[model samples]
Target chain A: MPHKVIRMERTRDHSSARRPVMVAIAGDSAAGKTTLTKGIAAALGASRVTTICVDDYHRYDRQERKGLPFTALHPRCNYVEIMEQHLQLLATGQPILKPVYDHDTGQLTRPELVEPREFVIVEGLLPLYSKLTRACFDIAVYLDPPERIRREWKVSRDVRKRGYTVDQVLAELERREPESAQFIRPQRAHADIVVRFAPAEGHDDTSNSPLSVELMLRPTVRHTGLRGLLAEIGQRTVQLRLIRDEDGIPVDALHVHGYAPREESRMVQKAIWSRLGLGDGDPVATLGDVGNGRRSESLAITQLVVLDHLLRAT
Target chain B: MPHKVIRMERTRDHSSARRPVMVAIAGDSAAGKTTLTKGIAAALGASRVTTICVDDYHRYDRQERKGLPFTALHPRCNYVEIMEQHLQLLATGQPILKPVYDHDTGQLTRPELVEPREFVIVEGLLPLYSKLTRACFDIAVYLDPPERIRREWKVSRDVRKRGYTVDQVLAELERREPESAQFIRPQRAHADIVVRFAPAEGHDDTSNSPLSVELMLRPTVRHTGLRGLLAEIGQRTVQLRLIRDEDGIPVDALHVHGYAPREESRMVQKAIWSRLGLGDGDPVATLGDVGNGRRSESLAITQLVVLDHLLRAT
Candidate 1:
């Protein structure tokens, strides 16, 4: 384990001592990590936010991993030391030659020159797997959608984009489950916010209805004005309540209804947008979109909420 | 002012004393009163639920109101006495001769027979305007969408369905504004739940984004298990928080996000369903729909939550 003081010191820039705010989004495969990061990037403007998939550190290609004793989820499957070093560099507003892993061909591709921007989002399966890496982010999020829903998403995505059959995807999921439990799920304990998109009760027709979102807001960072905002909106589009997390720690849980009408969502959005002092600019237009021409008021608001912490840090 | 004790005593039947659970949904024109009533009726089974639009109690025709001192929104513009009597009758599970007002032709049409079902839903502009009428309801809901959103809805609806020009509709809205303020908006204070629908901020294109819903759960009714359910699900779909109402009463406000996916909505629905002992049947398939083949998980859950209180009273 790395010393906390060392990682803490690295968060400040070496030259100017004014560090870029770093955010980490960790999740299992197909758990909506990139989707969330993408919306945040778009919301903050692409130039101001830089996104890096830390899975680029995979030590073996897909073909090599197949013959290895352990799965890619294990710490030994990647260059953990190098990943930690690069994270420290990025935290200090330095640049690095980051490795690349291509999912289509399942191979280690070309390395790329990566520079830290005003805001850096590190997303992948293991971004928060270790304390050293976790310390790199000012705000860390874990995407923990229900296992069944995640499986469905994985199968659909693999079939559409990776040319994989349902059977192959299922088999891969089984292979990954053990390591996921050992490595990925534990990272949630370290996250400032754990977000899950799942079906609400009696809504078994997940095929048509949108998934509702639950955000377990851990006490790692100070979340100001959210309680006041939830009170004023007085609608179910966004809710705030005190709850005990899995660790039995008292936390504020905010649930954003996915099937909420646009009208209900806007009130909460306005509350968050105003609180962030992002001014009267259009946060919903720029940040509210979640692709497929569908705009997620909650997603946009969540991004802004996360941005609130980063802005405060700056 | 009607005596509360007298009206309360009249709620039970005189003979067998088996009263139908009465629900009142009040809102301004085109504020989604019918849409909400339809979903609730569908959820509880249309045969089991009788819906009556109290706007049918208009004493004068639309043409007659034009020559009167006030607009249709005025209590004097409606047959409030007859409405109060019929509501009392319905609360005791009796039948009544209901008058009809045709919005399409703006005429006083033929009267019809109405028998109270197991559940009766009374929705209109002034269902909660009078103390006598308010006592007839087991649950009262006010559709309090944002003024601008309601105005947009009114313009579109009147232009398409009533064959009125946009300018004409706007003029009528302007004409009705004072009475709306005096009579309609105040009814919200008496409601157990004030539901608002609005376009999320930044999503100016209401046509493209789904409307969000916020539910103000007043303390007048004891909402059991909702907070526990929110904590257990650990999602943002259903959130409960302490809020101060317009009258400065501290209340528990539950917000149901409109853009929530079916998965998240289903979880909350199941919790509320089970708590209400609604059995294992599919309320989401029937009551969850918002129209045009869309299902609102929050709307469905809200219906069930209200049903819980009614059942408890029974």
Candidate 2:
């Protein structure tokens, strides 16, 4: 892993001195960072959460910054240090005066006040880019939607919501390709967890269908603190026999191949849960479904695992 | 006038022909450039229009461009020359590849192709700043809403649309004030028509109702082109009168004000059309009953006059 993963050992009750719990969701534009964060935040409940999209700290208005030596994806184009400072402040349970940029008109709009809560979810492209920023997050995840999927989402959004035509959107996709590859994609290596959502290929699965969401856990965390949830994830998990790409590194890549049978997935979930030893007797059943669509069997599994660990550790 | 006004002796016909007609709508951010241009384009019909927001051309992503030196409102922060060249291509009815930037995410997105039509609305803070770009537009207008009104509008918009709270919006407003005065407001003098919208204040024989809207047309036409309409609008023409400040400058420049008595506003419309020789005929009737509530009434009136003149002259 490009990032050093520190094991979070169970803290003694006397050590509970109100530490800031920050979560970072980093990804390229249209990479589903917002959606993934939304799920996590909703499950965590709004009272315990607050979100800060890094886009708020942009340096220039859309028009003025064009054709400059640098593009927005570059760290030099924005107030990254200030953002890091703000992240630190939030993690320390302090309030921040955040900037607002208008998207439709491309203006640096008024600012907003952000008071920290139990969790601060920072979601944006460069959230995990710097060591300083990475240090702010208690947990970090990267959304790795396929380029094709991102492009589709971008084209539709620009045309429908942003008043751009299809041709205009396509042009942008091409122009940003180089920077995206160089600046954005590299952030994934630093992620503690990488979550990607895609339609089931060669399967009769609608978007909300029982499509398997692949969550790659670093080999460093075999326990993942969510063994119960992993066991519950069951058939949704595709343990890819651990292979690395010319990297002498160990890889624990998972690929359920998507849209797998629900029954089989249920069984897999149970096995992972059994290992955690909290599947049956606990109130894990009380956890509501938290995944997208009615196809949320996977969500129940994740919830059980997370809640179990959270409760036991507390 | 700050900008050299260019007017065609006759209406320029739509063409795949050479020399794209660049229409520039320059003003401070949130000075109603986009709102005004959208009305103009829709009035002309999308088939004859293509719009390019100058904001789409930013050179940096959200994080890279901050605290460098100049504000995004300044010319140096942008690739002004390149944008001017692009404008040259666009004005002559040619397809040009344009860059895209997502305002919400503050990222320079992919590039897209823009096909020219009869007209293109190139709008932004400094769309009119560069001399080369100035050469591209056949018609130029500036929206200079009143300072107090602008501040309020800005605060409200940032809070509602841009994910900002009241205090943050106020602070940003304070920060942007200097740039707005120096870079944006001055551009108004360069326009053929400087538009001001504000709420209509009390006058003799006018009710205390809140709906009255007043449009102050700077360089108010020497002669209301439509003779008959001019006569009817003769005395009541004080609607175009803008109160000047102590410096003998428009106290509240480009203020879009509201006036009550819907009938009076309709009369203004009727009088305008009567001058154009369109009369209460189909073209005149096609205009819906406008009131203090419909902010676009005055703008639509101006557009109708221009379009009538264009179609008739051609």
Candidate 3:
């Protein structure tokens, strides 16, 4: 053993008296993980939150993946062990030097230092991919928008922002479907809340109606004050019902209708926000931004619900 | 809490059955840290050793440092917290995504994944700068060559390899002297062994004599077979004596005379190697390389002693 040295401690103290609350929002590509994460982070204030995308752990850049038999969706294409290790560090209120994967350039850039704040929102493809990863989160969410809607969102985002052709996006989507089913979709079963955004029943897909959202709240984690809040806000626009989950277990399904007037969603958001005991201010207005100044009432309500869970966990 | 998913475990297992033995080699810039580290790593076999330079944690690049009042020697100038966190990880036989500071380009480049093997050699300016860092090592070494020799080595190496002009190197050295005294030199007290390589006392400075080495072995850690080996090999070429250290404490000073013949140094090296119980073969031939095919007998002997400590620690 080496001799121990006793030196006066230096450097800014990074130890937190209380560990940061951790939330995981996991889904497949273009599944609105980032949008939902942005809302929760904004609600918590930027200084109090740290948001990280675990896709930055990709083992292969886009060009390298092209040469491989598996797509980026496969565990082999990512540094999953490193991701789990980082998550464990964050859950324990420590810091990590996180890797950066440039989505547009498809290159691994320099890493950035991530110091966990009062709240940490980890959103990516594999945040809930394993039991070890799942153990690091206080709340786990899986985004499961209708397949058609998700495909459309992917094409629009990649072509407009990521310099990919629509045809290229479609081809990539087709190639990733098998892995998506094998690796990504299976994580939904482990989530405390499964969120799906899609058109309302009997509504035309091409119509100008905003997407409605269904939040399946599993009993795995206690949803304190949520069921009562849902029951109190039970109008035509926001409703709560009992439904059988995929595992044939009874779970509460909360529905937020998109076409409902904005004021109704605001009422529900305010109702949930008030339960947080965070004062009388309305929820952040930017919660449901879907790009280009477009906002969805359903998205805002779903974000508020997730934010409620994060605060309760803390 | 999130529900745990019972999925088949995947990804490569990184947990080691036994933690890797860690060694810290601390010294000032151009103080033969890397040269010493290379010899040790080579002796241990590259596959069984992981060597990292802690200077990679620089918070600023060359261009950024120019605008600051302090040099890289300041603890604030580097990400000391992250470095300590990483050292703890490596000490526990875990992996780290280590940052890279490109010396040639003066840029912070992409991080590399470092997995600790049977032996880990961490060499850099501030490995022993703090108590937390010092606690991570099994054997701590400090290089303390004379000021003139160290300056000459710095100027030669930086000018030839790092693209710095002679005048710039000299000016930078003058600027860094204060911090070097305040930060770097004090770590010598915490080391298990202090090694100084310089010309023999009465030898002319301009002569081509190989640098002699004097190792100050502290009583902080047990130097198990070393005293007996020194007594058995006592000669004019290799002498062991007690000397009052800077702290006024008596310590064993082992001198390997650079003026001694090669056969005499070989005998000492062989004697140390045999006691390691590794094999009857001679010590590693590459242990004393000082670059450009040059070899130093004194360096080889010093490395053999350090290697002995590492093996004993395991």
Candidate 4:
């Protein structure tokens, strides 16, 4: 198996006796990692989950990296050792002075005290790139949207929120491609779950239709059997398949159709909710919805699957 | 495992015989078996495929079956022995004088000669119920739409095509429920694939939207890997997942979202065609496009999956 189950080695002095489970969400820039993290925190209840962006660990500010040969994707460009030490502390139920990088200003801003909660979600470009850092995570996910879709999302996000023109975003993508390949994409092979969200091939209403989602579940962890859930729904919008991964290891792949009929998705959603032992009302309401009313059922289900594991972990 | 792969006995045969690959699609009355069978035949090319409805094996005419205590779904109401013998004959590429059951007139019509072709799809109420008959097939599928959805479909079909009143059809469904459970539903466990088509939940425009489809791919047969095809299309609407079946057997399930964005479905359709080694034109144009221009992508994909196996068998 490409994914090895992590055994955390706690190394810290901490006040809280309770250990917080850490989850790592790693992906390239503008890969919706933050959006995913926010949704997860919301679903788990914000007070119970602490969210961190390790991009703040960059040793050099954006302006400083501009003069350097390497992009921020390089390990040398970031305080890798410090990040590793802090992760070790957090994994053992301690607090850390987490650094903050202002994405809008392209500068290292204020540092914040992060106390470990019941759950800690670390989302950034290179969370799983190192063995020491990866050990802090009980569950690791790699977001791998298609290049075209990611480009579109990144371009639009940068232009609207960060005062960058489309040309600048595209140029940055070109410059970061090599670094992303070297430092980021390889993390996918190590992930217990790989999620890809993309537009359906010929969808005319691209702006409105929910993006389809494909989740590859590596056998690093056992999953709650879904046959019963699928039977209850009796719809084909959600499917499960046993397949061989790229590395020729057996894995389970799950697909959630984007244009899933409302009833079908509801039945599945309810089934998942009940599985998680959650109460009524959509737990994944804010998930992947962002500014739009439209929500991806596949995305919600993906979140639920992860949450299901975390809940059962205790 | 509930589903066991069939191994042909290869009883008796004649001629310059190349054995025809047999497929059994079993379901309840008006469960869309004929429609599914038609699509399969069309996709494989009509000349190269032979379609058989085993409902013809009904030993009693419709009127006769009604007078008896058992419904048409009961095995005793059908000529099980002859049906099994003929299936064995057809399995090895022989011809049979198939009995005809006419739904329009509720009569046993003239028998027809059915010559085995490159592909043979046997679709009806109980094709998979008997072990001998099931062993004649290379692949078997069960249609298992939700009871509510099926009731609607059955009522609409019987009223429109067979001149049955709504009340009569509804009453018939009630009467046949017992036999359907005893003789038909159990066949699902024996099938290599179980298919369900239903309207999306909570949608106001249920009639306008295409029904979603879910297919459970049991380990009764080895399936052509779809990961490569999914990757090539770069769409998330069609997905595969590994799940445990009801019998605790691991299986792969595929779901095609209904109301699938046209582009998404088109991409999947194109991928399936290419997977089948077919050219640019759709080999399944007539598939699942029952009426209107609207087509169920899930249904078409289901057909393609089965077609993929049939084509590979030869």
Model 1, range A21-130, lDDT digits (tens) per residue?
A: 88899999999887788867776777788899998888788998989989888899987756775676677666655667888998875455577888889999899876
Q: Per-residue lDDT of A19-122 in model 3, one digit per residue for the tens? A: 78889999999999988888788778889999999999998777888799999999999898789889887876778899999988999887898998989999
Residue B198 in model 3: lDDT: 88
Candidate 2 residue-wise lDDT, B1-314, digit = tens: 10101111122233434444456777776666666665556555678778998866555555766655545666665555447646755765545546676777777654455677766778888777755566566666676667766677677677877788999878867776777778777776666555665555653222232323333333433324543343445334223334763235553222223443445555666665555543345333354333334444555555554444333331
lDDT of 4 by residue, A71-128 (tens): 9989898877557756765776766656677787788643555788989899998889
Best-performing candidate as measured by TM-score: 3
Error of 2 at A176 (Å): 1.0
lDDT of 3 at A26: 96
The iRMS of model 1 comes to 36.3
lDDT, candidate 1, at B236:
64
Q: TM-score of the candidate numbered 3?
A: 0.94
Candidate 3: C-alpha lDDT: 0.85
Candidate closest to the true structure, highest lDDT: 3
Q: B208-270 in candidate 3: lDDT tens per residue?
A: 668899999998878757888877873756888889998998888988898898887888888
TM-score against truth, every candidate: 0.47, 0.42, 0.94, 0.47
User: lDDT tens digits, residues A193-283, model 2?
Assistant: 6666666666543344554455665553244445334434543445444566223565555555455566675665555456544436322
C-alpha RMSD by candidate, in order: 33.2, 21.1, 3.3, 32.3
Per-residue lDDT of model 1, residues B1-314, tens digit only: 12322332343235753478888999999988887787677666767888899988776787677789899888987777567756766776666546677788887643555778888899999999986787777789899988998888889888877899999999989988999999999999999888877665456666557666677888787666666766678366766778997789887777777676767777777777777665667777756565667766666876776676666655
